[model samples]
Target: MNLHETTVVLVAAKTATLAFGSALTYLSYSAFRRTDSRALRALTIGIALLTLGVLLGGVLHQFADITLEASVSVQSVFTAVGFAVMTYSLFVDIIDEPDRTRSGARTGD
Candidate 1:
């Protein structure tokens, strides 16, 4: 693709990622209010990080061709880390919630 096209694609990707991140943040906040669970909070944070990674990936792709040599290597690294952490937190949150609820029920009984 042409440089212009590539740049456009990168910009679009970045915008979309950022938007998604914002939405996730909002949803997480809502969930937090409704559930007051740490797992939900962690999951929300992870979603935010994932969104950030997407944003950084887009930026890195766009900067790859610029004359200014604006490298996205660091951003890419952070993105990967963020994705990993977020994914892990999300998984933990998913798995832990059921156990927490079950324990609470057993205690009540």
Candidate 2:
């Protein structure tokens, strides 16, 4: 494909990524609000960071005229940090639900 075609495809892919990331972030935030769980809050933040990485990377590369390598580096850092938070959210017992079991079954409601 030519340069124009490649650019179009890249932009389209980035747009789709942004849309899906935004939806995921919204859903995560809603869940966090409903449950008031610290883990959920962390998850929401992680998702938001991941989405921001995509946006910033695209904008830096396309609009700011930054090098592709620099943009990708920025994106990678965000992605790594986001995944770390997400992993922490999964492994740490940030919730204070005393009635909840290890199997995730609520002992009382």
Candidate 3:
């Protein structure tokens, strides 16, 4: 549609993204707390970074007099870093406990 309509749609979409991202970050943080696992902690941080990127981008565009492209660039940087951290978390070892079999039996290393 027109420019104003498009801007409104973008704002709404960004707000929704922020809301959903916040919920996801909270869930990840809760999971990390329950397990006390380093990987889970990293995952939580990654999720937070992603959510923060959206927030920062919005603020920059709306209040910092930054160009839309620049704001999006900042968001992209955070997203990339967040994904990298998540990937690293996958390679991290689990808690320092004996390995468990599928049936929940502890196995010797």
Candidate 4:
């Protein structure tokens, strides 16, 4: 009910969201490596949602003036990086798929 309690709740929620996003990103990457269709799709969606969640959480925390401690910031940065990588992987996969592009080229190639 108090400001501190509210901030603590938000921080905990953000942490959990970031952890789940990281797990999804990792699983998706693993699936892509193994050439699993389900895993790849899961990863794409998971990473996308995770990215959104991270952005939203960061914004919310900033607006609320909540300090997520130094460790959380580190974890958040890593999570953001992971999300970026996964997103890039998904983009590449989509662009590289023969059905998705003409001559399988990603422009200017």
Best-fitting candidate, scored by TM-score: 2
Instruction: Provide the TM-score for each candidate, comma-separated.
Output: 0.61, 0.84, 0.82, 0.45
Looking at candidate 2, what is the lDDT of residue 81? Answer: 96
lDDT of 4 by residue, 8-108 (tens): 89778877876876776677677767886653764566575555557655765677676656435744665676566656655655565646664466775
Over 1-109, each residue of candidate 2 has an lDDT whose tens digit, in order, gives: 9999998998999899999999999999999999998888889989889999999999899899999999999998999999999987885563555445778665666
lDDT of 2 at 33: 94
- Model 1 over residues 15-48: C-alpha lDDT tens digits? 8878978898789879988989776777777677
Query: Which stretches in model 2 have alpha-carbon errors above 4 Å?
Result: 94-101, 104-109
RMSD per candidate (Å) reads 4.9, 3.2, 3.2, 8.5
Ranking 2 against 4 by lDDT, winner: 2
- Count of clashes, each model: 0, 0, 0, 0
Instruction: Write down the lDDT of every candidate, Cα atoms only.
Output: 0.68, 0.89, 0.87, 0.64
Q: Could you tell me which 10 consecutive residues in candidate 2 have the lowest summed lDDT?
A: 91-100
Residue 29, candidate 4: C-alpha displacement in angstroms: 1.3
**Reference-based TM-score, model 4:** 0.45
lDDT for model 2, please.
0.89
* Residue-pair clashes, model 4: 0
Q: Which model, 2 or 3, shows the larger lDDT? A: 2
